[model samples]
Target chain A: MSTIEKNVPGTRELADLVREQEEELAHLRARLAEWERTYDATPQRDALFSTSSGAEVRPLYTELDREGSDPGNDLSLPGEFPFTRGPYPTMYRTRLWTMRQFAGFATAEETNERYKYLLAHGQTGLSVAFDFPTLMGYDADHARSLGEVGVCGVAISSLDDMERLFVGIPLDQVSVSMTINGPAIILFCFYVAAAERQGISAEVLRGTVQNDILKEYQAQHAWVFPPEPALRCIIDMFEWCSENTPNYNPISISGYHIREAGSTAVQELAFTLRNGFEYVERGIARGLDVDSFAPRLSFFFDIHNDFFEEIAKLRAARRIWARRMRDVYGAKKPESWRLRTHAQTAGVSLTAQQAENNIVRVAYQAMAAALGGTQSLHTNSMDETLALPTEKAVRIALRTQQVLAFESGVTNTIDPLAGSYYVESLTDLLEREALDMFDEIDALGGVVPAIEQGWFQGEIAASAMRQQREIESGGRVVVGVNHFMEGSEKIEIDRLKIDESVERLQVARMAELRASRDSARVDQTLAALRHASSGAQNLVPAILDCARASCTLYEIRHAMEEVFGSYKEPVFF
Target chain B: MSESIRKIRVLVAKPGLDGHDRGAKVIAAAFRDAGFEVIYTGLHQTPEMIVSAAVQEDVDVVAMSVLSGAHLTLFPRVKALLDDAGADHVLLTGGGIISEDDMAALDEQGIGKLFGPGTPTTAAIDYIREWFSTHEAV
Candidate 1:
């Protein structure tokens, strides 16, 4: 219901400017008509000249495209209101974007080694990728976890595993980002307990947890509790973290998975910002101050193949979020209006054939992310389409960012595309489209309702189907997939394989931890957590108590599930 | 008089905790568009649920996508359950982030052709049709 007409010139000034440009515009139109007549006579190559999202692109963009908009309002300076240029005035000039590669596979010890290796190789921050069992709040020994333990990411079933995962690493010096949603609270508590064991207090902890569950229903499909209870847990984290972990972001509202799930750039922008707004509303409903929690709220987006569109998406995201926060939500703090984001190059855009070509694709996407003013980025590796990236591939992905930061000289200027006619016009167009979509979502009674009715899923699936058809029917040209001739080319990149014994090792470790931990304390703390889950109290303290008692991830989740129950997605394609 | 032909019924099931269902849903839509009956089992279906759905739906093929690197454990389990349930004729095939060597190994174990990333939907459609033409009695 929020309007995007916040800062506009007076009607009289607009009328006068239009009057001045009227005669020139008429002349320009006549010339454009004559040029079009000649242009139509000349036949060009037959192809689709549109963005990956199916938005039509005109052959040329000029001042006519940005005719009536006030440049001062639309293209604001960096560090100003509606930050379309960049979030900060000195974006990369002061500090480069963090090259945080999302890495984990097999046991905690193995992943711990990998983390140390990445840190030694100049990776600026740590992003954890937990295995399926850990992400779903299942123990390594659970029957549902058979064959999946530590396969996709690191398997941390207990505080012991979490402690081992961060062994030898100083918690105070390194910032960690955990990509967990379903059991984000449990993992977060374990992280705090692990830091406490290292003699570090929660006040100094700095990191982010991908605790977004709305997008889980819409795109990612990872959830433990139903929408209402899942939201309660997220709000509880917001309340607790605002008081305790001042430096840590409790939730990273994400559009990366949404874009990866086959949404258009505009859909990704609209859905993600709407989800962030829903969280802000929920946090306010919980009686928290907007500035207290909104400043800590961060964003994650996907940098896809369309370079200008991706950049425009980021610019539009910041402008829309800033306006909504200040104008609609009444957030007075400037920090609340700043939309800081972490971006990752699109993994869905990678090809399995001619995998090395992915390196080139990632380089361009990384550059786009850099130009888009991301605070941090994770570039996809070439071999990622086939399996988990090998060590060398991950290093190269990191080096891609390094080269962009240093060799590419893109960081020399902030918002280098700020005044370009095409970028500014596209940014405005994307913002308008997002506003329209927001109205559509508003008609559907908000994000959670739309998700329950499968509206978001349906839209994403339709776009995905359209893209697939385009690829198959030769409407789109993917270098090695449908267009290029690379018959009988063998993939030669080294693929990382998870050792099967890692699961056995984790299961045994879980058993040993269960046997050695004090059963009385564990049961007492878990009972307290279960009791607190049904009440309106902040659940973090109780969860942290359970973590300190050596309770496992599934144990904490089951305690909540006893009251919240599980979520079964509505079955649809 | 012309004889009527039964449509190829396929169940597109996602068999593990990995929630990357883009491929499964895309393939399901492709199959539906290609004039085949696709029963999408949605996300997080265990091997048992997949086999039961395939049996209950009476599908000609049970295509399960396992992208969580659990293919070695899941594909074989589903295939064995299909065989044990006296439905061995159902083709157990799907696609994911499976490597070529693993695909060969799964093929050796009687799993059908598995597709990887960036594969055209027509390839799977043609494969399923050719599979049905040879394996089923028209």
Candidate 2:
């Protein structure tokens, strides 16, 4: 306190006193040091040690932490051999990743309006979430589709709805990502037909359809056809897109749903990459070259609340996929060997009680996404723990991304947190763990067998149970929920409710679709689709034919059900 | 011994088009772990199909977890159909995205439990257990 006691007029007097104390302080310090040699002794065991996966704490990290494992050689340059840093040399410095948010709602017109709004609001790309019927290969107003029209997302039945969905939007410029899996090819065809009506060619079209069906069986459970045919449809799209839609990504093999389905990060990485590997294997088996399709194959992952762990996950994912594609698959082209992925912040982790706290959770999750260097990012609206996000909520969510992108100053450096002992070690550890899981998956002959045998589901279920048990027992703290529950916080949210009239209106549209379309062509398409189901022909062409003939998803699913029979899941213990 | 020999079948169906099934799936797992033979009708089950399945399976409880707010229309029809089928013993219940005032009004119509977002999995298991244990005598 006395160090600055003098006024400015007397500042020289204070400096003189400091000079006076300087000699006295040195003498006192010497005496204190001599006394400390005899008196001051404290045990030092305070250093915290832990693994990169956030498991097991210890007192220190050492050569033993490496434990006969080499830190391993990382390749130089971003787009070179094993792209541990990123998929491109000048990432985001030259151009930022496309900001793609999933958007769809009650009606085609509604979703179109939303899409135009998002594009106007600094969003660089669009991702569509079709309603259940559209996803399950059903059209609205089919008997099976009653009461469920436009419930989860927009209902796209035939070309008419597709045209309306993209009326003012240009297909040639705007890249659209569809979240449909089962009837992916047909849905893409519906988009194609709509685009053609607007005079846009396939070559000019852009974006991806998350057309990965294997992951659907393993995680999302929105599959329509059996596995082999589903794979055939996917491979056909890979062939088609590789040859035609050069600007479009054919499939986004998904691990986001797998993680959301209650898997650990390691399981998410291994299972998703393995699924991607299987697709590439299938594509190669179809006599297609690896370089042709692998460049367009993309991955999707979940960015959960674990910050460093999620970052390590992305880094490890790229390294693991790069190594496997180059050393194992012998992919000659550098693009074929890199792993480019899109990330969505964890939806399963958001809470509704103290929904405001979810904004904090999403901030950290979005930070993790950026740190992971995602090719695309979709930040979930804080209010999405309930229904589809309202426009106000969606704008806030998008703004959160913009704030992180511009103001955070995180983009000033590449991999800014790269060399922290914790981060680097965690990166190595995550890769090893995921690599071990891949070995385990390979021992079972890959993802399809693992899915069919319920191995994937079983692993996710067990992890989910453990996490739930932790939460229920108060071991985990979801603040303002179980632990800090305020019981009755006056929550008044303007919940976005779908009008009952939406269903009525949708049913009328479907009725007109049925009456106006050629009934003869519709019946013939359904019958031919049935025959294709019995035979071994790739179902994509036939499904596209049916879509072109204006047959609905429910009609085809009904006809296919009669032939392929429904799946009866074995009781997973 | 006053016969205590019935397993309370709780059919947990995920109604409508919400594919966010982690809660539904976790609840199904919890119910199963609690020794209630829970029949999960997968995702995207319609109201009519869910009610029909419960009746066909002769379940004691019909618990549908819908994060989508279609419960206003979906749950009432299930209760009405159960009444029509003379299966009043089958307690109709639902949870997810429901408010207290809405839950109270629905509870007045004999809906069993209106579990919402933070309602613990253990609490659900316990409610089902206690309710079934008490009502088996009737």
Number of the top candidate by lDDT?
1
In Å, residue B119's CA in model 2 sits off its true spot by 1.7
**Per-residue alpha-carbon lDDT of candidate 1 for residues A1-573, written as tens digits (9 for 90 to 100):** 113457677899989978888988888888888888888899988999997777798887876777777777766788888888888888998999989999999988999999999999999899999999999999999888999999999999999899999999999999999999999999999999999999999999999999999999999988899999999999999999999999999999999999999999999999999999999999999899999999999999999999999999999999999999999999999899999999999999999889999999999999999998999999999899989999999999999999999998999999999878899888988999999999999999999999989999999989999898888899888898887746526888898998889988988988898999999999999999989998989999999999999999998999999999999998888
DockQ of each candidate, alpha-carbon based: 0.85, 0.41
**Number of the top-ranking candidate, with DockQ as the measure:** 1
Lowest summed lDDT across 10 adjacent residues in model 2 chain A is found at: A45-54
* lDDT of every model, 2 decimals: 0.92, 0.79
Off by over 4 Å in 1: A1-31, B1-4
TM-score of 2: 0.87
lDDT of 2 by residue, B4-122 (tens): 56777988888775665667878888888888888888777777788888999989889888776667767777788788888888888768877677688788888888888767887
Q: In CAPRI terms, where does candidate 2 land? A: acceptable
Error of 1 at B43 (Å): 1.4
Clashing pairs in 2: A49-A58, A137-A553, A138-A553, A138-A554, A139-A553
Tell me what fraction of the real C-alpha contacts between chains A and B each candidate also makes.
0.87, 0.34
